[model samples]
Target: MALISPFLPPGTINNVPQPVLTAKTLSLRPWTAGDTPVVFAAHKDPAIALWHRRRIEGLEESQAVIAQWAGQWEKESGASWAVCDGKGLVVGRAALSRINLFEGDGEVGYWTLPTARGRGIASQAVTALREWAFDAVGLKRLQLTHSTRNKASCRIAAKTGFAFEGIKRSALRHEDGWHDMHLHAAVSATPSG
Candidate 1:
């Protein structure tokens, strides 16, 4: 029942119930109903919501999201996580959304809680997700997109080895109308014999 990333190295594993990636003081664990509050708080920050599509309303909405995430988790088609701090408070959210097995690809999306910003949490979360996608799901390539103005997100991608692929004009519609986005990707390294 585990997913095999057809394009990854020979030994990649996928869809385990435990964490697939970890950082110095943080961990990325699968999203659950209890994590909704963290997700809600993270999205409350204007900086985090600027690039995303819709805004979260209140606890009720968060609950609904958690429900949907639970459903997705059951299927193994996509995955989401609540990034926890050393104290275990939900500090952010990260996801490997839009996975396509036939195409051997996945897209990463993430946001750090406002209070957790400027501490390298976003980068760590992104790195963890990329490792999972590459070594767990065995995706041949992983892609990320950030509105051109979202320099911090772009930097996160670059810091995690996602090479700048290109810029797509008017690719995303934010609250401020259409915006340009920079695409970045990390391709699997061919293993040596």
Candidate 2:
């Protein structure tokens, strides 16, 4: 057997600072300690906590999480951005995790503040993140998965061009129990006409 060469060379993402991405009404920027309040509040929202299956106990923990998100860029394992509205209010989050540079693939995830829901914030942020993952980061594919019951996430995946692949049986565990997950994916290539 022969060793497979990496699709994207090491340092493709970690070599430079993560760039801020913009959508029509959103800006996805690196997370920082200044976002502690919003992060803490978002984690406490019932809807967010239910879907994300975690809670921030305090501002200190939120700040630590923000710092960890920032550090992931240097580690090249993942990246996260705070999705801000035009006036600079943090409304959501967008991220790429489980990045495998060798395979040029990663997983995508996002969540919007309860107050910011139904305004297309998640869709816009995911779109921007997808573009950056493929074009700038040189990823070949991005996968998105959400609980089958998460209709909003399903819609966001569709709107962001992640084609539905299939369902994974009891793939993720939440507070209630394991839940079936819908898997969606988008590749960086377009068919030639």
Candidate 3:
């Protein structure tokens, strides 16, 4: 039996610099150490803390997280971007995690700062990341999962053209308990428009 070839080559993502993607009102750029304060503050929001289930704790931890995000790019394991508004204020984060080059797939995750909520920042950031993942990085599919109780994330997934797949029963655990998650997905062949 012949072994299957990888859908994307190993250097597909790591060969070039992680790009800065721009939407009409938002820009998604690689996270930097200087953004540590923004990241630390964003995690202080109760909603973000509840949904993401991790805290920055302090400036030091935030800087470490940023370093980890950058290292992931070099390792070809993941990519993370800091979402900024038109005026260059860091407002959120968007990322592709669990990237599998052989499978041409990755998982999408994002969160917006409290002030940026209800402004579609997450949707725009996710849309930009989706395009980069599919077109530039050569990923064939992307999956996004959110806690069932996170109606906002569900809306973002739908608005960004990630079709509703189904629920993953008790898929993740948070401070409260295990939560059912809604899984949404998008494929490269399908236009997000």
- Best candidate, lDDT-wise? 2
Per-residue lDDT of candidate 3, residues 1-193 (tens digit):
6488888879988898998999879999999888999999998899999999998799999999999999999989999999999899898999999999988899999998888799888888999999989887778899999999999989999999999999999999999999999999999994432
Which sequence of candidate numbers ranks them by lDDT, best first?
2, 3, 1
> Alpha carbon lDDT of residue 133, candidate 3?
90
lDDT of each: 0.78, 0.92, 0.91
Residue runs of model 3 more than 4 Å from their true location after superposition: 190-193
Model 2's alpha-carbon lDDT is: 0.92
Worst 10 residues of 2 by lDDT: 184-193
| Deviating ranges (above 4 Å) for candidate 2 | 190-193
TM per candidate: 0.86, 0.96, 0.96
